[model samples]
Target: MLAALPVAVLLFDDEGLAYANPEARRVVELDATAASSPPHVEAPAVVDAVNRARRTGQAIDCELERDGRQWQVSASPTACGQVGVVITDLTEVRRTDTIRRDFVLNASHELKTPVASIQALADSLRLATERDPARAASMLESLEREAARMSQLVRDLLDLVRLEERTGEEEPAEADLAELVRTQTTRVAQAAAEQGMDLRVDVPDVARVAGSPGDVRIVVANLVDNAVAYNRHGGTVTARVRRAGDEVVLEVSDTGIGISPEDQQRVFERFYRVDPHRSRRAGGTGLGLALVRHAVRRLSGELQLDSTLGQGTTLTVRLPPAPTSVAAPAQPPPP
Candidate 1:
């Protein structure tokens, strides 16, 4: 009967190991002798099961975890009043459960916030239209703006989902970090045209890095874009890239309205905005900093931010220099 059981079983008296099956030893890495020995921790379930089974002479079970290992354990008493116990490992099962719960919670909060805002704006517009024509017009305008904001929020959320799914150990190789800056700046330069903001780049031609070009672009370009977008019309956005010891430093400084000490801590959180009305009106998606954080981690880099409200902001990214194996090519040998 014990041979037919799926679990690892151990039988013993108050003294020690009277019996131990193969499964118990395999699951807990315990020998038959060690099985019946007093367990390090008190297992009430095992003690209760042993006492009850001794009276009925029946089999029973329990569950427990030790040293980060999950196990289902059972205890029973034999006809002679001795105890029988079993343990089965469950580490993988518990890990799967935790991952599932976190995914569900994060997804729910992200999808719900924008949806609630949109619904409230629509309801307000409807009430205003019924009571006052002039107020209705104002409400409609406000509703339109909120609807656009919600639309952008939804788009950014979708982008985040896609990025999260795609994040893995893989990254780009032998990427000319400087070129990426040149290309993206050229494209975003037009957007800053109306602001009269000056976009300057100071990257050497020989400089190159080893990482995903796309990720590095996301980290640096996003910061520069944000700095330029948020700056005053006549502000300056200066981008500098250089090697400092074993790290590469890429910085973007702006003369825009800076962040307050309060909003600084939360700037990296999804959907957080320093100035909700202004950010929304400017078509800010609120996912930029979150994206920056993700990209920085992927590149094995650090991001530093400094800002003073009413003055400006500066963002710096420091990445480990390309590995020795991937450093810029050696110069040609002399004749």
Candidate 2:
């Protein structure tokens, strides 16, 4: 019965290890002859828990880290004058908890800035309207901008949630990657032009991929938007799509203030921004790249980033090609 348990179980007497189940043998080194030599548990914490449980004749629980993994060890006195031990892995659980905590803190911080600005702007606008009529217009404009920023943040948050919860229940369809690049690029071209930046698009006749059109559009739009948003005045933003063997490749490159090596590693993380001030000024929600990352992963695609601090940054995405027999329909330009 002990051998059938899923968790690691061991029976140890005062002399040493009397029995180790298959699960326990997998977790710790067992001697060839259990009757002669004691088994070795590399983790000191586990050994201590067993010794303490035997000495006190009570159950003792402890946690330990071994071989870069987290383990929860429980040792208890058995009826046969031996200590019974159980070990369960807790690495994924602890890591998930840490991620959940960080995500909440970051989301709260991101929302707080816009909320506070909206509150202050409303107060100033009221004062301006009453006593400083000349400045009232500008205050109203500022208030609108803050409201828009918050709205965009909420929308992006929803998008992130949807992407994370995607179940792939719907059949994948063939989406024209080339068309998505062109359409998303055009949508952001005016913004690029307003910033005195040149926008360019290079796409093949048809670069099709097997994925949901919505997911592909999210990936393309965010990349193009980021290129335009982070670029310097008079910089160039290029959106390109091509067929690469069995994959469809989309690359967005920008001559902008590039990300540092350290920042690049974490840019896809939710609410992470290399230039927080600039990001806010550009009406960024700081969730665009995160949306792109999630959408790409949902489609079983690969994403890569290359950048230099002052020169430029380029993001590349490769997705599986659609079946040869599938036909991609024309997608209307985004409004």
Candidate 3:
């Protein structure tokens, strides 16, 4: 009967451990034949719960943490003074709760920024239009900018939700990484030129993967756009596509102010910025990397980040190559 149960179960008598099922022994990391308490299950709360259940002949419940994992623990007293203990793993449950909490808080903060700006801009425009037409025009421009920002934020939030809800049931199709790299690089070349930066594109004749074309483009566009946006004047950005075994790789490297170690770990988090003030001034919504990460996951790909404090940052992505039989029709190389 204990062997069929899902949760870990153990019985403790006055001597120490009277009985421990396989689940209990595995979770507690203790010898089932040992007559002492488990060393790894040393949470004081568990001990207290067991002692209280024995002393009062009443049931007790508590939470215990061990080795970075959460466990729900319950102790019930038997008629003979033995304690029946049950433990349920709660690590994944706690993780879901944390993700939900952070999403709500971060979403609220991001939405509030542009909404507040739009409101303040509207008030300034109203007052300035009556007395200062030139000031009113500037306020109107500010209002438009804030409105656009809010719109973009909403769009990005929707994209994140869609990615999170992905079912992985969509049929895959051939998508050329080289084409995506070339198209995205060209689209941003003008922007890079305007910023006095050079954009370099190096790609193979064809590098294809099995995924949605639109999704691939989104990934490439965001990476290339960020490379251009974060780069310094006269700096250079490089986009590359190549094949590694059964995988195709897409890489974007930028000569911008690199991310600090602390920020690098959180750069993929929604609305997380290395420098909030600088990011805002650079017109960054802070959702680009987050979206890129989610899109890559949906493609069953891997993303790697390499950066230094003052040098630059590089993002590399690898995905399974499209099957030869299903590869897209070959197109002429870009001139």
| Every candidate's lDDT | 0.72, 0.85, 0.84
For model 2 the local lDDT of residue 320 reads: 92
Residue-wise C-alpha lDDT for candidate 2, range 140-209, written one tens digit per residue: 8888888888888888898899999878477859788887888888888788889899887777767778
Model 3: which residue pairs collide? Answer: none
lDDT of 3 by residue, 1-335 (tens): 99778888888878667777788777777765564553344457767888999888899999878889989999999888789999999999989999889989988988899899998988888889888988987888889988888888798889888888989478758788888888888888887898888888878767879888877877898899788888888899999877776788888999998889988889998888877887777677888999999999988999999998778889999988888822333455569
Candidate 2 has a TM-score of 0.88
List model 1 lDDT by residue over 88-131, tens digit each. Answer: 66788888798667646654765566567768867876787787
User: Where does the lowest 10-residue lDDT sum fall in candidate 2?
Assistant: 325-334
TM-score of 3: 0.85
Better of 2 and 3 by TM-score: 2
Candidate 3 segments exceeding 4 Å error: 4-6, 13-16, 35-44, 78-82, 204-207, 325-335
Better of 1 and 2 by TM-score: 2
Candidate 2, backbone clash total: 0
By summed lDDT, the worst window of 10 consecutive residues in model 1 runs over 325-334
